[model samples]
Target: MSWLVTGGAGYIGSHVVRAFIEQGITPIVVDDLSSGHREFVPDGVDFVEGQVQDTSLLERTMREHDVEGVMHIAGYKYAGVSVARPLHTYSQNVQGTAAVLEAMQRVGVSRIVFSSSAAVYGTPDVDLVTEDQPTAPESPYGQSKLIGEWLLADQARALELTDGATPLQHVSLRYFNVVGSGTDEVYDTSPHNLFPLVIEALIEGRTPRINGTDYPTPDGTCVRDYVHVADLATSHVAAATAMAEGRELRPVYNLGSGDGLSVREIMDAMQRGTGHTFEPVIGERRPGDPARIVANGDAAARDLDWRMRHSIDDMVTSAWQARTAHPDISE
Candidate 1:
């Protein structure tokens, strides 16, 4: 049986697709290509180009492919942009997730792995965030993700209450800042993400800028948890494997490194990795910029084999190499 991967042509989703294939599981991709690239979907994989909100299309794909599970990753991911486009964000993320669940119910698919975000925590109160941390999402994107998690929980509970219904086995992986490429075939292309912004600036012979430098932290810049996309993909596959094998798993897990790197530190890494020595420009802090937010991943480490297999240098170098490899796409 194959697993349906929504947004499988995107960066992190593409990595998850590759991980599934490496583990001998067939993956069928459904992506709208709004923010994702079609070429990112590996050759030989069955791909359907359509919106996740297309319930009939998803149902047909699930039935045709004999899908056993779903990896729901397609959504409007920009937190700042979501503030200006709340309706569009809700339509794509909240409604999109509902459509996926609806199709799953119709097809008797009982497993799912949700792509959640640490934005659910907003500006976390503590240095180390855990699954138990209070959720106070600050943007439509974050709220939509939290709502998506709720949808999965509610659906699972409803299934448990139904007689003769296959109970839904699901897990939501909350991620922080995801960077690096699992393979040179796909790289981070988000214009809003820090890594890509910096890498793109360097490639275009422009100096990267730091948004906030007066925040309370070493080097006076925002600090955030950064994890390799490949490591994140590994844990996603592990979650899918555990569920398929009837092993118990948590309802949600944070895919994060306990430690964080400051913006200045990241700039230094960019300089070292890319052989560019220009200092970054300091810009006014973006509204709602937090001082720091890192997550404790002990639970994920124990249950999902989550670990920071790549160092900061590894992340920078790989991202640079991958971005440089696709110069035509760089903006």
Candidate 2:
């Protein structure tokens, strides 16, 4: 049986599919090509071009592929943009997740690994945000993710109430500033992300700028966790493996580096990796900017084999390599 990965044609989803292959498992891809590339699905993999919101299509794909589990990563994932498009965010993330759960229930697929986000924590007060902290999402995208988590928890509870029904085992992975390219074939293409923005500026002969250099940090810049995409993909596969093995797993896991790097440090790495030397222009801090927000990944480390395997330099290097490989990306 194969694991169906929703949004399998997207950047992170593509990496997850590759990781499953590395673990000697089959992957079935389902994507609508909305913000996902068709070329990223890899040859020899079964792909169904459709949205997760279409429950009938999802059910059909699951049944046809003999799907044993699902990696639900399809969603409208831009947090800043979601502020302007709240309805669209809820429709894609909230409604889309509900449809996936319903399809799983119909097909008796008992395992799911959700792609959650650290945005659910908003501007956290603590330096090292833990899973136990209360969720106070400041944007619609974050609220949608938190609500998706609630939907899974509620479904699992409801399934337990059904007599003689196999319990729905699921885990939601909260991602924090996912960066780096695991493979040259797949790299982040989001317009609003940091790495892409910085790389695009340098390629276009413009200086990459940092926002708010007066933050309460050693570098006078905001500090945030940046995990390598390859490492994140491996943990996602591990969660699926544990579920397939009938091993009890936690409800949620945060993929993060316990200590994070600053924006200035990231700029330095970009310069070193891309061989570009220019002083970054300082700009006003965006509203709701947090001085620092790293997460404690010890729980995920103990359970999901999560670790900071790649350094900041490694992240910048791999990302630059991928960016250069695709000559037209900056254009």
Among the numbered candidates, top TM-score falls to 1
| Residue range 1-331, candidate 2, lDDT tens digits | 5899999999899999999999998999999999899888889999999988999999999999899999999999888788889999999999999999999999999999999998889878888888998898888988999999999999999999999776899999997688999889988888877898899899899999898999889999989899999999999999999887877888998887999799999999999999999899999876545677788998899989999999999999999898789997546
Which candidate number maximizes lDDT? 1
Cα-based RMSD of the predictions, in order?
A: 1.2, 1.4
Give me candidate 2's TM-score against the actual structure.
Answer: 0.96
Candidate 2: regions farther than 4 A off: 287-289, 329-331
Query: For each candidate, what TM-score against the reference?
Result: 0.97, 0.96
Q: Which residue window of length 10 is worst by lDDT in model 1? A: 284-293
Candidate 1 residue pairs in clash (backbone atoms < 3 Å)? none
lDDT of candidate 2 at residue 157, scale 0 to 100: 99
Question: In candidate 1, what are the lDDT values of residues 127-163, reduced to their tens digit?
Answer: 8999999999888888999999999999999999999
